[model samples]
Target: MPGRLKLYHNPQSRAVTAHWMLEEAGADYDLVPVEFREDGTRDPKILAVNPMGKVPTLVLEDGTVVTEVPAILAWVADAYPEKNLAPAPGSPERGSYYRWLFFVGSCFEPALIERMMRQDAEPLPKMMVGWSSYDDVIDTVEGALKGREFLVGDHCTAADVYMGAGLWWGGMFKGPRILESEIIQGYIARLAERPAFQRAMGG
Candidate 1:
């Protein structure tokens, strides 16, 4: 087993998703809170590990640093196979798991940012952007959860943790159509009921 991990986090940021994943995996970890500064300078400790100075930066026992939410979630899930937070390697469900995991960072987040942050700006050409359009991204996610309890197999996995966290965060911020959709809201509610999720939220 790997030694205890260290996660640089800020509760108000996307690091919460990584925190949720750590809880789900039942991994032994320490939360190193990274407070934001008015002048926009990052903690030197964070910069010493990650030049980007992003939260959710995970330092492994071997001193390796893992940045990005999805990568951290994937690593923790794999590191604790006994937790069953991931599908069996090379299984068909694993493909779907990876699909949704990447979907959040690649599509959902970008689309959400555009819809929430770039409302007044001219809509970028769909062909020129990786996320295409906000509507399409939301539709795709809704379709994925239409009749399924989880993103991959029958039970919760790292995919659900990642996707669920994204949807929950989106709804919390009143992202367009996210809270309005019954399917999305139901999924968020279901995920919120998970003990790990609740703990991550400090409940």
Candidate 2:
């Protein structure tokens, strides 16, 4: 049966990741675009769903409200295994898969945001910030993606969906400096070649 997926989205945001995930899973979903005014105010109804009023919230057919980007993608991937978007826990690949998934939210994201801010907050203790330094985090990313076409390996898993999307966005920004690696360049170019990515970009 087709899963009922309600994607609260706007093309201009990270909802594009959710959009690509939906397309990859071949899920039956309704893409609902929520609009805000030029002054940056949102509908009271949307604020009810997400107090932060962020885009890309996924509401399951059963009415479970999922928040955050990585959480939503991981949930959607696990919910539909036949789609093969994730690696099973018992599989050796699962560990590495989870690493990238969590890294996207835990490390890469915060680091990217900090770089974009061009300001630093009080440093998190080494143990507190999962990603210690921007270069360290990026070097880890380079290591993970260096020799492989995908994060874990040859197959594109949910990890890549998030990682690749994050790469695409970071590539747009001046920080992270990913293009220098031939591997990263090839991998990101591969992601861009995906029909889903193309369609998302109006290809």
Best by lDDT: 1
Question: TM-score, each model?
Answer: 0.97, 0.89
What range of 10 consecutive residues in model 1 has the weakest lDDT sum? 194-203
Where does candidate 2 stray beyond 4 Å? 38-40, 119-128
Put down candidate 2 lDDT per residue, 88-154, tens digits, no spaces. 8778888889889889988988887776775456555557676787777788888887668888857
Which residue pairs clash within candidate 2? none
lDDT of 1 by residue, 12-129 (tens): 8889999999998888899998888889898887898899988989999999999999999999999999999999989988898999999999999998988899889987899999
The Cα local distance difference test for each model comes to 0.90, 0.80
Estimate the lDDT of model 1: 0.90
